[model samples]
Target: MKVITKILLCFFFTTIFFSVHIKAIEEEQSIIIEVEGDPHKHRQYIEDYHPLIEVVQVYDTIFTGIALKGKASNLERMGSLHFVKKSYPVRTYQTNINRSVPFLTETDDIDTEQMKFTGKGVKVGVIDTGVDYSHPDLSANYKGGYDLVDLDDDPMETLPEQGEPTLHGTHVSGIIAASGNMKGIAPEADLYGYRALGPGGRGTSIQVIAAIEKAVKDGMDVINMSLGNTVNGPDWPTSIAVNHAVDRGVSIVIANGNSGPANWTVGSPATSPKAVSVGASTPPMKIPFLEDSFEDKRIELAPLAGSKPWDLEKEYPLIDGGLGEEELPNARGKVVIMERGIVPFSEKARKAAEAGANALIIYNNEEGILQGSLDDSQGPIDIPVAAVGKKDGQWLMDHVTEGEYWIDTTYQNIQDKIADFSSRGPVTTNWNIKPEIVAPGAAIVSTVPGGYRELQGTSMASPHVAGGLALVKQAHPDWKPEQLKGALLTTALPLKNGKGLYNPIDQGMGRMQPQAAIDTETIIYNPMLAFGKIDKLKDSQTVDVKIENVSKETKTYHFELPQNTHGLSWQLPKSFTLEPGDKKNVSIQLSVISNMMDKGLHQGWITLKAKDTSYQLPYLFINREADYPKAMGLEFALKTFSKEEYEYRIYLPEEAKSVTIDLYDPHSLVFQKTLVTLEDTEAGVIEGTLKKRNITENGEFIANVEVKTTEDKTYNYQTVLSIE
Candidate 1:
């Protein structure tokens, strides 16, 4: 009896320990980890987690996907990794998300009527190689071109232009305002040129800056800078130049970059705050996965994982061979994968030729592999070479796709989301936040530095935003870069940033929604421009327009400052023009400060205005703001919301320091009206809270917040009231 009892006790204790171990894992949040980049990296990462979490393997380099154990469903809507969207008229985009629609090629990606650029003579500058004047789709709209590279006539490349025909500049120009059968968002708009990058997509920040300077000087509405740099330095000329451009009323769009895993990283030019940054997004559709055997080819042109060569495309052919057969078995017209460092990737290609291979796949020595091309410095070799990670290489070894495989060959590069490769943001370096938005990067079909081709990277994504910016510009030509920036940022829709539970450093602010930004109803700072009024703004300079969102909610709208003003000088605007509750920024600049002498006395008062509220600045007739304290504090009480979302009430106690509230008055503190809650458990209550709180503020002031459901509907109740 004693022995049996002891055995039972041991079993019970063992059960308890197992239960505790299981519980610990369940409670832990998802974490990102870096391990060896080998073919077994993913397996090794999750090897110990067996019975804890089940994984759906997609690639060899893939360690782990996002953890969905307890995340929101909306955030986990990955399309390509799940379902795929149908191809757009141009091409199909694969995504794990089901609800996301494909590109606008077939079904309108955006409301065509909203474009508003029909007759508007706007010019979107493409600061690439140059615009192509010959492509069937882009010919008619080719206004004229300039080559910043050679600084000569015909920015367009000739037949002998050192690069591929795709570098003609027509493809990129088309994406901006493709005038062919498939209408571009900015159709009917003029195409401007500024050749920055050269063949094979290489250019300097100085050249890019020079292009922007020229575009601004020529008064182009939008300048498209669809290239970037991975490394950062003390002096970022691109960012500095961008600030000046915004101040000058020109909007610049820059590409993020192609490199991967760069947390908080963004491509140059795009990282510039004064410019709009763009990332990549997959096509919201299901498409074929184009694949060919690498072992059949002699040259490496696929990603590094494609270690072997295969014959499939038929476009390329093998000249020699082995294996005791008439020709090498896998050495015909297919991309090959070769290992780098073993006598150089290019030299390996030459060796493969002697062995009867047509293509080469050169992967990296790192635990994982990568895909990139080698320059022409090596001995003569003419075949496509592809690089990949070590892990991907091993996977390719297993899934050799045979002689031919169903692949979306037309599809772009690896849709693998990364951090270190993404542009870094909140960069104190340039004093600006970058990568304002993200999109699909791989296999990107956009304008190439030289011309037309499917180049992948954040480089392709930036042009999309620039084109969108042009469309926005057409709608509001008077909008200063500040106004446009505000609408884009505040109105951007939040989505899964990366493979992590939260936004991976790679995914900046969030995915940009072109339509949503243009239609939101909340009010951020509302500043009105008065050319030469009370403030005595310089006759030719821009007037600083200070605007702030006292409301504790997101707002979006279109704004425009006159572009005709000459000699304009004002800190154009903060890289982040839009603000949240209480944040403030200089709205406009009055160039009259001949010396710092007129700085203090210049009196051009910018009237604050918004499209949706009673938030308006009347003629200076209501300027009693001088009588009140610099700021007013709201000390009222109310109910609080307790659900996932919280709503509270604030009542302005009936004090008469001042009756009205104004945002512009130096002495009058403004309260964000949207945050004012009207909910009270009882039928009557006086509840108010200061919308913009600052610990450094002193003295006291009073502000009146009027609540209105509609423009003409105003409910004025000074007495106690219930906030139901």
Candidate 2:
């Protein structure tokens, strides 16, 4: 009896110790892990040994990979397995919904109304956060696809409560195949949705690879991945997988990323040499307005994330809420105007709601209108709230000397320019020109899960190319992926920010002219020219570019270099002609203006002028000897303006002796010439304010902040500002 009791006690203590000691992983996270040799074999190996790890999806054709779900401890053990090549946490992508509808391509003259083809029979795969397969605009053309996220047949978008649902997949699909009144670039193309990303717009690279392998196996003609992470290299697993897919005859178009205006920000997969990485561009002319009884002020209004739209027709007394809770007595039944800074936007809106206000307006204390969100807290906001540019908000506060001043809200058409937030590049390390093409991305309207909505980012831009590529493929079905990419690159239009040519880094090969791409007979084989880095001033390099004549007729071409922009000198062929189906390789030699250039990115364009068309091929080389920030290293943010006085926080690695700040009108792109220079700056967060100016107009502008060290090296940081 004593021996039996001791045995039972030992068993009980062991069970209790393990239950208490071992951390219970209640919520399992998904991951994609690559394996040596074959993923199927490796998966079998995991099932045999790492029994706790769940193998969800496996890829064998394009690459050996598997999707997994398991506890943190089990996942770590699985990663350590002998057969595992690599394991990465699944990441989510966020939808950058900032705009509304499909006029983007019309501006490029790629009108489907006049086109002979609408991507009929072309199978395009969208590897994203799944699509709303039943969206009326997309259903007719949806050919069905796989959902890697749920391991199901129906690839539908699912939104999580705590996460912001990315309507990205649906939006991208619409760009490729939406029909009816809102026509896509490829209005008749067949779309397959591969739901790799979950509702939160997040997915692992391996899952994406699995999707690519599936799409390739399913015989997809084109794959659109408007998703990426900041890997900035072509050797990443997803990039290798994408390259494999391309080799298997599928054209892949990826978003260059939305981390733009900065150099070397092009993310992975898009970093793949064969992929058509896209960027975003805005229209040239836009008219922003706020409806008012006195005058409809042309102002840039930033809407809060969860704030309901105001009832524009209703009129109510507008009261200033800057005096805080103590002044709530005067804000009853009115639209309370609160100054931003001390309290959070949600808190301010809540206070206004508590004060019995009908609506809320949070004005900036600095230069621009603020983009606030009432989403940080749970539950619905009771009042309609909006943010206005600082200048306009202040003018309203000062001009309303009488009672019951009410401002009405209305939406208007805004111009297309490079969105300040759009990702820029010379891909990292390689310094290759990225964002091979730009498309309308800002305020773009497309299909959401249930209906249509506007989302911004390179995500929107890539689908435009995907849809456009469908048209291209339909036009030249015999062309390979690179050839189609070549045609588009050579036929694209150059976009400028009003001041000067937008650096190639900001807008690669410029915007896409889809019609021109379809009509072009000649193609440049080397779409991107990366001179790499010229560490020494005297270094000279040579590269050969191949051009092909795709048309039945013979074509003549002459290559010319744009007058040396960055101390770059180039040799171009005087003239060359290609017979039908003929290919020609031309050698070009490049040398730096060695003595003339300071340490920075030096670039130039080589234009191939054909009989009826011309193509711009951009080339860039960096100087590393010169002390310059790694483009992404410099960070800064502008504060809301109070009157003409505004401030900014600039972060840098090296200590700065002085800072030279310049302002430019984003519309004009012209330097304002008024320099706000600061001296004796420290190494860390350097803050300074712009003195009050006589500026009264409300619009968007750019701050060209420059930091200089005692060594005379200069680094620049650019940011956008709104005058409310």
Candidate 3:
């Protein structure tokens, strides 16, 4: 028996190596091809047509497609084949996890114990770095799962002997259904792991899609994926797969990417219109801020991960430490301020600690506040380090230059505020409001591989909603996936920022209220309205809202009168009654006068009253063609197998007439050469490869992307690209 097991393991490792070796040998690019007919037959057709192309995997459950690897030219030519519908490059994704279970449940006044809906019998699949099922907290409910990366049934978390150890999946799983000391929201739910991402918490699109297909085949009731790439297109392959999974009767929850405080940062899978995308919000906590002793102006401080907490109690003199790249002047028992550049954040923190500094402050080089983490590879720093925005940093620098400046620490008890790092969105093409809701993600403690740890991200927030949905599913087993989603969105608590209510694009209907969702008798589909761009005067758009009376009693619904605003008029449906268990669709029309309205994004909320309960539906519209980026998310990298070949991808929100990428010397600003150009490019992601022959030099170059839209308007975006 031992000999047989050893032989099987050796064969598995060899198969994995051979698969990777094939792609590394040639200038082959991995791609997922959506097919018009059967995927299995399509795979065979691809092989017969392009003899050298290799089909890695076939998916049919969630998405009908085939993953293959071939030379760029061969792959491009395959697109012209009659059977092929569309092709997407297999982009890489990383595990992006956890938190206070009671914070989430208690915030909504949910009594899981009394409700008797602890997600019993619900099969929740977690697609991430596999779970550590051996942990005592997860053993009972850890049913079974598959490892897509290793092509095996044992979906255990990556161990040290493997490439890079991971605990992300375990943390997420614990948040969903752990039954031991660290109780999850859905403690009795059955847990299944789908190891899409392997070592280093990284994997390609093919693995993720295969895992989704497996989960669908396994008849999962709910799926939670805390992994995503930085591509924001709604039609991206992973996002499309998510939509298909929802159509197959599985509730899916995804983490809105952690690229936040900026619009259009929400990535794929989260961009899926049908998936429950979640953003990170703070649990009740006393957040620390830095205040100037003289002016009493306080600046919010986000502590760097892996650093000591900012808990200073006394005022300390502030000193400018330049960039903190080299040895600093003698400074002891004072806060050292550094600019973010040249040196790594961890290195600066280490230098500051070595100089006996009490704390360190690093400010952004750009306009917004810096969200950063210290590199743990260099070991941990002893002193507390925090980040501030560029304006505050400049103010501190000026104060230090003129006279002695003393800074004191202050604390503010905050709750339900959106995390600065939480990605915001009005998804590019479709204009849907992503992160349809928010949840407590900041400073959440959950199960890790060995024990418990506190972590925070939208990755953590997503599982909260997933677990909440599991409870809702247990209460209403007959509800469709759409109904399950509506329960959460329509009943969420609308949150507010310092200025006022957060925009619909930022908070959607707002923070999740699990108890309200479970007890509500009505479900509002399309709870967030996105009336896309209105270009002409007196232009009108209508959205049909689906409302279901899921209760035992008949319900009458009516819309509240919106505040009068110039240039916009709304046509609302009359009060109507729905019989028990019946659903109705009502149209809401909005007419806009472009010249009378401000030419920018306008947003607000519409209230709907059903019986004694009322729900707030967030609404948004662009008065005219707003100045959103024409082209963004440009990525350039050398092919893993061949250094001489480079692959690039850029996102076009709308169809463009032409696109061009030009390179120039970073230092001298001298024109190098045009990298690539395409005509009549579609509105999704455009990917291609560049050969070494096209470039005369190798090093860092500034990439200037010029995009000409079909409307004859041009927009430019710039980023740095490197060649070796």
Candidate 4:
């Protein structure tokens, strides 16, 4: 989300072979990479390589003079040369790459028509802070809990904050098993609350693992984890624990991180194959309305009768138009009228006094009055500063038109309008596609310890999906975690956001449609077959294939592969055949160069490719494991997102002719490696576009954009992308 910039953000690559003609201009000084190999020695060139910038050319290979990152330093290797195979390179886009927030809504939307109709007698578990055991809506569903964080067997005691009260866990528990009047997805399911994080929303990896262990031991049908760390590397302990948990029948739903940047790759348990990840979506929004009351503490303690009069002493002057007149003309030591805006309530009061106004009355920009100020707290403003709902503001506007007084030195709001700062997606950084099957979030009226809390976040969205999974599991107690996850993925419905539509990269197989997944009657296969060589032809450039089923049921399907127009060129047949539980590998072979096309994102999914198709088996995302710094750029002008777009230009110094740019998603290469044309510019200002793409897979994708100066000097830059 767009956090205040002041907070140090804890928000937490490819080849192509092309010739270049650089008419050397002047001496250059940049890191140079010179590859020397026998020009005529084909296979030898691919196998042997070295970085020769300052060292003498010792190898028996041609010095394809220093590629300042791959551009031509000298204009010579211009005319195209023919050969059997050539290494492909990646295309480059602007360093401003896209990202996705991979998550699920745990639904059965696509084929809701066929799902088994029944509420299985199954209970689920929410391994979080704790649950609100006594609320009208969720009270009947609150089964029980344990405090994993405090190491307590009692789920009720989350922390000392409640003097034997806990909030986080209770809320989570309610989401999962809270049944009766107000319903949860698995209304029949019981709950085992494991408070991992304390009341402050803080917890370690150890605590989370502990919660998982407890849930598994307690026979929890489903476990939901809605929190995560920004740093995700190979050595995360949560991963190890969840992998073990998966071995058992217990299913898990983990939340993808909310912190953006460094493309907060899926952390710990969420990255685990069996852990179903739930990403956040924008909270439902409606125009703000003027109100007189709400459920928050601030609104509860409103003045019943006559309260203290507005104190004018501490009022400070606001900018040019303080509450006085030249302004208002008739108003003096009276209450001032202000629009709901940036300044704090205290500041507004101070400003009114500075202008000789006694009281402060502010209204929201929308139709009615707002319940409370998102920034309102106690103490700053000396004079009384009160707000009215949006409707009141409209009335004030209407009053002014009628030549009547418009000041109401009072604050009133009934229902609280949801705050808009709540983060939305297609997740901007991680690959979270949209529209995430939105469950309740934003001022959601849910159960709490003393009473209830109107909380919001992906955290809320997570438990809803978790609760739904409980129902799915209850229905198919025999299904494996993979089966459950596949159902969620395969039966998802794709949605559109500001950035086009959600893709696998961003939304991860689309938003979970529980009912659809539950009702699906057929299988849609997108298998990654390990096809062995079939034909041995003399220098054959192509090969054929077939399919066999190794499943318990007989099946027929169609196949499709990603477009391979680059170096590694190949395609598959449209149709294939299979039988019950048979071993069948499609036959396909090719004699292509290793570096075929540009390095970036590439996919190959096999599906029914037909109308009324069913059963889709998704292969994993294209991103591979790679290591990079876990921390960088925390202290910068990083806002949630900028409505204002920007442009950038990288000019190649005259000494450099062509430039090669590579985009990466973390250490993994993303889009096609692009080598842009930068010649004929006396003043350097190359153009680049930040185009958005729609994909539908789940994984953290990054692009490493590099530039090579004509003199062989190279520079590398990495950035995050989002195209759900």
By TM-score, who's the top model here? Answer: 3
**Candidate 4 lDDT for residue 547:** 33
Predicted candidate 1 versus true structure: per-residue lDDT over 1-724, tens digit per residue? 0011222222110000000001222342221111233424444444444334333222221121222121222212222222222111110001000111124222354554544343247777878766666666566666775554444446674334566432524555666676655455566778777765555444443445556666776678887776654323212445566777777778777776554443334434554556777766654522222244553422223322112222334433322222122333465444444445636554566656555555655455554225443333344455444555666554454444343332213332333233233454433222233455665544444433333344445655665666667656666677677667666554544344344222323344455555555553442322323333222323443434345553456544333332432334433443343445545445444453333232211222222334453222111111111111111112222211111221222222122222222111123223323334342122112323343232223233222334332223332222111121
* TM-scores vs. true structure, each candidate: 0.47, 0.71, 0.85, 0.50
- Which should have the higher TM-score, number 3 or number 4? 3
Q: Under the 3 Å rule for N, CA and C atoms, how many clashes does model 1 have?
A: 131
TM-score of decoy 3: 0.85
- Superposed by TM-score, candidate 1 places the C-alpha of residue 298 at a distance from the truth, in angstroms, of 26
Q: Relative to the unseen true structure, what is the C-alpha lDDT of residue 456 in candidate 3, on a scale of 0 to 100?
A: 74
User: Model 1: residues >4 Å from true position, as ranges?
Assistant: 1-120, 158-169, 181-183, 198-206, 231-234, 285-327, 330-369, 372-388, 395-421, 426-432, 446-452, 497-504, 523-724
For candidate 4, write residues 1-724 as lDDT tens digits. Answer: 1111212111211111111113344433121122334333532332243222122111111113221222223212211222221111111100000001111232334644322422346657776666656556556656676665434456653546544444655555555555544444555566666766654555544445656766777777677777664323322346556767767877777765443212334444454544666654433332222222232112211110112323333323222223222344433566565666666555555556565655556666554324342222333344445455556545555545565342222233322221222222222112223222333333343455654444445466567677667656766677777666555565655445546443333444445556656655433322222222212222224323223342456566665554455544445555655566453445444334434333323333334343345333222221221122322111111111111221223322223444443322333223543323444333222444332221233334333334544446554434343222
Estimate every model's Cα lDDT from 0 to 1: 0.42, 0.70, 0.82, 0.42
Q: Which candidate tops lDDT?
A: 3
RMSD of each: 27.9, 15.4, 9.1, 20.2
Least well predicted 10-residue stretch by lDDT in candidate 2: 13-22
Task: Score residue 248 of candidate 1 by CA lDDT.
Answer: 76
Task: Report lDDT (Cα) of residue 464, candidate 1.
Answer: 61
Tens-digit lDDT string for candidate 3 (561-679): 89989988999999999999999999999899999989977889888998678888888888777766677656666543444666777888889999998876665666678888899
